[model samples]
Target: MRLLRVELSRFFSRRAVAMLLLAAALLTALVAGTTIWGTRPVDAAEQARAEARVQAITSSPEYKRDLANCQESPEDLFGPGADAADCRRLLAPSTADVVGRVPLALADEVDDSGIAVIVIVTVLMIVAGTTFAGADWASGSMSNQMLFEPRRQRVWWAKAGAALVGTGVAAAVLIAAFWVALYLVADARGIGTGAAVQTDIRWMVARGVSLAALAGFGGYALTMLLRHTVGTLAVLFVYAAGGEALISLLPVERSGQYSPAENVFAWIRDGGRVFDSSIDCPVSSAGCDQTFQLTLLHGGAYLAVLVLLVTVVSAVLFQRRDIP
Candidate 1:
């Protein structure tokens, strides 16, 4: 307990951690402010005017003709496999979109914001964890500390505890602020703040918090094994950003489902259909079709397994390896 306390105090005192937390807050505010600016609230009269214009445009002969032409056009002329996104874009009511007077903030927008927060906070946690472990070695402080404590695993546990606590606290605060800002924007924009919205909020909050915490812990474990900061961040970025994209190009079934990003997103989105999946038709599809890689519960369980594996491996290596 004393060791943990010491670690926590030190963790909180670090300038890097402080900077990371501040950056997270500022970025959240910036995003919220920008969102609110772009979707600023409109009076009923303005909404009516916008809707009227939208109706006129959609009902216009030109738009209707273009819509028809796009639907009936050949795929070879449009470049290839054009039967997917064309009609959906053309037919979706512009007035009902983000700039439109949509009643409720869509589930997808909430998921998008949640994913952004998770990515931001998750990387911070990983960097914090790596620096927490790597700094002592870099500064030649670990040997001196070991002279007093001697037990390397105990030291590792204390640092890990401190990392989790710091990250948990940071993530909770950041996510809460972002969610609040989101609803404020929603409410001000006259988007429905109804039961369904609240339910999505609840779902996102639960999954976002859990995902951030778990990913942070995983980051901590990886840093402990690597014992450096640069390599850890590089590997994490590749895993988080590039891993899924590279894998997605493969013509493999369910390719998107099993990636780290998709699995976490599966839980974040509550197992709803995800992005970059197939569309019903490129231009003239009658209906949209979608599928989930994993159910909500399964995605959660898979992530838990991943975090556990990283943690166990780190602990084993920490116990066996001589402190550098």
Candidate 2:
């Protein structure tokens, strides 16, 4: 308990971690602010402009020609069973379409700005974790710390715990703040988020926080193994870029299912679909689609396995290897 407390205090006291957390907060605020500003209720002037644009588009010769053709051959444009009524409904221009702006929607932001904020925080936390561990090695303080504690395993786990707890708490606070800001903005604008959407947002925030914590743990482990911040980052960069490209090149079924990025997104989004264009389709087979569903369970398992492997290897090496 004493060691863990010490490590936690050290983790939070690091300047690098402090700066990264501040950056994450600022970035989250920026994203939330942008979403609110961009999605603000369309003013009277904008509404009038949109209405004028819609009127102009509806009265245009090109639009008239397209509408005429659609009504005459609705099935051709809209597939079988599509009638002239469908053409009329689809061809009509609306002020909403012309304005191309929507009021703040919590549900939509969950998939958009929400995901972006999570990714940003996750990346920064990874760096924070790496920096925290790498600093010990870089400053040759690991040797001194070990001289005091002597039990390498305890030290290892203490640092890992500190990284995980610190990163997770930071992520949760920032993500919750982001959501609160958006929600308040929406409420002030008379927009209501559905109960279902609120539930989804909560689940998303939980998953995002967990993902970030794990990522930070992984970064710390990798840095411990490599004993250099840049080395760990370089390795991650190569794997992220090269690994996906290599997976795409492999002639395997549902190649995209193995992509780390795809799985990460799947985990973040609960579940996601991946389209593998590399899948060879038989010419004789019609409507051959190459989309595959990646469940959250699959993504969660893959990430868990990967981080476990790295953490284990790193701990084992740190225990056995000689500290310079």
Q: What would the C-alpha RMSD of candidate 2 be, to one decimal place?
A: 1.7
Using TM-score as the measure, which candidate wins? 2
TM-score of each: 0.74, 0.94
Candidate 1: segments with Cα more than 4 A from true spot: 43-108, 185-192, 240-242, 245-252, 274-292
lDDT by residue (tens digit), candidate 1, 228-261? 7777788888877888777777676556666776
| Per-candidate total of colliding backbone pairs | 8, 0
- Angstrom error at residue 32, model 2: 0.9
Candidate 2 — worst ten consecutive residues by lDDT sum?
94-103
**For residues 208-241, what per-residue lDDT tens digits would candidate 2 score against the true structure?**
9999999999999999999999999999999999
Local accuracy by lDDT, each model: 0.73, 0.93
Error of 2 at 9 (Å): 1.8
